[model samples]
Target: MKVCLVGSSGGHLTHLYMLKPFWKEKDRFWVTFEKEDARSLLEGEKMYPCYFPTNRNIKNLIRNTFVAWKVLRKEKPDLIISSGAAVSVPFFYLGKLLGAKLIYIEVFDRIDKPTLSGKMVYPIVDKFIVQWEEEKKVYPKAVNLGSIF
Candidate 1:
């Protein structure tokens, strides 16, 4: 299966990386920030750099959405997964629209609250995974996977 793993750098990326066992053998590529850690950790893996300043930057969000649309069109992945920040919003929606199975993993750090990106994509995703049980209360449809760490 062709998988497109999308996430921001840092913790979000870390969580996504923890699923290497599942994705390592799959036909996969990443969409993430161009950070030193990301470059180092993902060395030898296929990747596409996403736009920065995605928290609330309307301009970059629009730009990234367009980029995501184009990439999704070309890659035509069967599945798209992410442990997210704001950068994931566009890809989640676009991937769903393009008939890709969308999986959103709630960041491991958020125990008591839902992330903005999680809330945005929850209703649309095929699977919503949360690391902590408390998060399940916030995202009732989410499955508690007991942490990816």
Candidate 2:
């Protein structure tokens, strides 16, 4: 399957990278920030860098959305999976609109409260996975996948 892995930099990217074993062999590419960690970890891999200042930044969000539209149109991934921050928002909607299955993994750190990205994409995703069981209270439809760490 053609897969598009989307996530922000730092911890969000780290958590998604843990699932490398799952996507490494598949036809996959990444949508993430161009950070040192992302650069090092994704060396030689196909990736589409996202814009910065994502959280609540309307300017960047609009720019990122345009970028996402282009990428999703060109890649035509069969599935789009994300452990997100802010960059995944545009990709999720565009990917879904293009008929790609959407899977969202809530960040492992947010146990008590739901993340904004998670909540925003929750109702639209095909699958909502949570690392912690307690997260289910916030995202009732989320499946407890017992941590991606």
Model 1 worst lDDT run, 10 consecutive residues: 140-149
Worst 10 residues of 2 by lDDT: 8-17
Q: Rate the local accuracy (lDDT) of all candidates.
A: 0.92, 0.92
How well does model 2 score by local distance difference test?
A: 0.92
Give the clash total for candidate 1. 0
lDDT of 1: 0.92
> Per-residue lDDT of 1-149 in model 1, one digit per residue for the tens?
99999999988888889999999999999999999999999999999999997998999899899989989999999999998898899998988889999999998889999899999999899999998999989999989989787
Error of 1 at 5 (Å): 0.4
- Report the C-alpha lDDT of model 2 over 1-149, residue by residue, as the tens digit: 99999988888888888998998899999989888989998999999998997999999999999999999999999999999988999999988999999999998889979888998999899999998989989999889989787
TM-score for each of the candidates: 0.98, 0.97
